[model samples]
Target: MSEASIKRAALYRMVTPEHICPFGLKSRDLLRREGYAVEDHRLRSRAETDAFMAEQQVKTTPQTFIAGERVGGYDDLRRHFGKPVPDPKATSYQPVVAVFGMALAMALAGSWASLGDVLTLRTAEWFVAFSMCILALLKLQDLESFSNMFLGYDLLAQRWVRYAYLYPFGEGLAGVLMAAGALTWISAPVAACIGTIGAISVINAVYVERRALKCACVGGGSKVPLGFVSLTENVMMVAMAGWMAFRTWA
Candidate 1:
């Protein structure tokens, strides 16, 4: 086993029915109601848990610590316990702009494609599979966030990863729809779906900005402030959406 394995080894599952995150205590209570004994704070900290593992002789690989510091396992748990880490909400705004810009660029790409020779039926099918694939990849990176993206309200603040996954697939599908629209004038359905997705992205972006929360678009691009570049990108997406609508009907 690699050293990184030991860093977080066995930590993810250390929580017992009783020891659940306070944020998820309702579930713990429900589990108790269902008759499983749970601890409220069975595994308090990484040091505590690591000590338990060592005592139990749980074999784990060493961890490669660049800083040679033991970042507490159960960061999720810590966050739930209200320990202060960098506020995800305080991330740089630049990432927010970059993410939106990517979305807008995708929208334009799809609009331009709609004017191309791709078949509408083929494009729609493509859009579905392709978008789902992107979603899948995003989910692969972080399933909890993806779950929250579709269902909303992740208590863990996993939204940033979800946003990253949704952006590319959402925009890519929009572009594919545009291509199909030009060929068969039947890509409207796909365009509509893409538009709906775009609207959602816009909503997320607006909400982040309105809340004055920094963008958590970590995997999507560089960490920076939301700025003019982002605004320009969104304008392009608007253009793409408009172009798709026109070409699909025209």
Candidate 2:
């Protein structure tokens, strides 16, 4: 679009003594990014802000007008530009990604510090252990929420609701024991039982039932989808348990 034909946007945002409205700034930036010439209007006080809103017959500040037409707020501007707006209620894999990323980093750091190597069998073990610990921490943050989500797929949790509540603690304990390379007898059994039950649950939910659902792997509040990642977690635990048991016997 030519400069003359480019849309002109008017923005009114609060710049009061106590606070500067962040959305107002965002609106102005968004307008500029969309090739709009922004006419920035700052309301310096609560009273002034209120007056502008009242005069405009709008409920919120950071109001935008483009080419003499009211274009609503920041979210509206995004929609106008055909950009995907973030939804607060939406499910996402961000929590699981962050936890797993951190676990991998910690595993590498620990391996380098102790064994002077980052790629070794011990590093793999530490990675799984740390992942378990981190995942457990997330679930323990809101056990009730975790249990609710977990019961949707976990056979044991569905049959015995208390298992859902105890799941985090069990995972945490097993992780710690495995990390310490101590009490393999206890940790091995615990890991095996939970992993077996979890794999069965995931297989049934994702394949047999063909139910699309959110994963409780990160926590109850997460939007992480249930599927391959959940299955992998169970498989990892099962493998770890078997490894520990073999080491014990050897």
Candidate 3:
């Protein structure tokens, strides 16, 4: 579009000495990036902001208006521009995929550097250990949230509430020990116990009962759908635990 025929958008945001509305600035930037000439209007005081809000009949600031029509907030502006907006209620396996993908990539890179081969037993072992550690980290980020979410479907957690809180620590400890190829007696048992419980819970919740739910494998606030991916995680842990123990014995 030419300058003379350019589209225009008005963005009203709060910019006071003490506070600035982040959404307002984002909306203005979005409009400009989308080829709209933005008319920036800063409400410099609480009184002015309140009056503007009252006039606009809006409870929030950083409101956008395009083509002389109100386009709401930053998310609303995104929608108006045909941009994708994240839905909090939606189910997705993006986090799980990301954790597992990064773990595998890191494992492969390490194997190539240390053993001169990416496709090796060490790589497989490291991938599972890395995945466990990363997943544990995510859960440990919000222990309360993870525990609450885990209680929803985990039979062990449902029966013994304290297990939910300890699960992440156990997973992390086992992963570290396994990665170091040490203390197989302790790490292997911990991994096996947790893995067995997790596998059984996943099977009961997603397969036998056929209930659709979010997986707590990633974290409590995660949108990862509970199903085959979750099942695989538990099963991998169980298999890895057995393999590590066998390798140590042999």
* TM-score per model over all chains: 0.30, 0.79, 0.91
Q: Which of candidates 1 and 3 is the stronger one according to lDDT?
A: 3
Q: Candidate 1 or 3, higher TM-score?
A: 3
Across 44-158, the per-residue lDDT of candidate 1 in tens digits comes to 5567658865864553312111133332333333443465556564545544444444544544555457646444444434443333333334334654444334333222234
Could you say which candidate leads in lDDT? 3
TM match of model 2 to true structure: 0.79
Q: Rank the candidates by TM-score, best first.
A: 3, 2, 1
Worst 10 residues of 1 by lDDT: 60-69
Compute the lDDT of residue 146 as modeled in candidate 1. Answer: 40
lDDT of candidate 2 over 1-250, digit per residue (tens): 7777867888988898899999999998888887788899999998998898899998898888877889887888789889999998787778878988998999999999999999878888999999999999999999999999999999989889999999999999999999988999999899888988999999999999999998899888878788888898889899999998898788
The residue-level lDDT of candidate 2 at 115 comes to: 95
lDDT string, candidate 3, 1-250, tens digits: 6777988888999999999988888888888889888889999999999999999999888889887889899899899989999887988778987999999999999899999999999999999999999999999999999998899899999999999999999999999999889999999999999999999999999889988888888988978878787788889889999999999998
Clash pairs, candidate 2, are none
- Of candidate 2, the 10-residue stretch with the lowest lDDT total is 1-10
lDDT of 2 at 215: 89
Model 3 has a clash total of 0
Measured by TM-score, how close is model 1 to the native structure?
0.30
